[model samples]
Target: MIAAAPASGPLWQQVLVALAVFAAALHVLHDRAPGLLRRLRLGLARRLLAGRAPLARLLGRWVAPPPPAGSGQTACGACQKAGCAPRPADHMRNTP
Candidate 1:
């Protein structure tokens, strides 16, 4: 008996799925390692900018470089501006 071919859907659906997966991977990378992600983006943008071709330059316009690490603000933007109180205890609540 001959085996049947796999039921593959439209090319666009596959492309969309691939793009979504790629985006999610990038998101995870950014969330887990923000500094590494920032470096990667800055490096890519610089490489594009360094290219002589106009298309590269145009693409480089996107992927803006992250602000200098020192100047970067916390999520709330108030912690660095004002002062944050230190926690009385460093141990986790779940752990003794």
Candidate 2:
């Protein structure tokens, strides 16, 4: 039997092919098999963060949030000026 070339042309015509392949691989690994494959992703993220200050800062920005205070959340300036609650240690302990 003889095979014929596709009328639309090559299967991988452009960079789209590389992107599609990458997306498909990620989908298959993470979406189709999340339970087993997720650890691989977690490990990759951890390794990427290790020993890289920019990556560490990016990850820190991603994971940590400023301490919350007051009612409604505010993204920029103009938040309430009330200071955080003071601890009991702030008061003097008499040593009679």
Q: Each candidate's TM vs. the true structure? A: 0.60, 0.41
Off by over 4 Å in 1: 1-7, 69-96
Question: Model 1: number of clashes?
Answer: 0
**Candidate 1, position 15, lDDT:** 96
Q: Write the per-residue lDDT of candidate 2 for residues 1-96, one digit (tens) a residue.
A: 899765565656756777999899988887678655656656655665674689675774454434347645554354545544434676667666
The reply for model 2, stretches above 4 Å from the true place, is 1-13, 56-96
Q: What is the lDDT of residue 25 in candidate 1?
A: 97
- lDDT minimum window of 10 residues, candidate 1: 82-91
lDDT, candidate 2, equals: 0.62
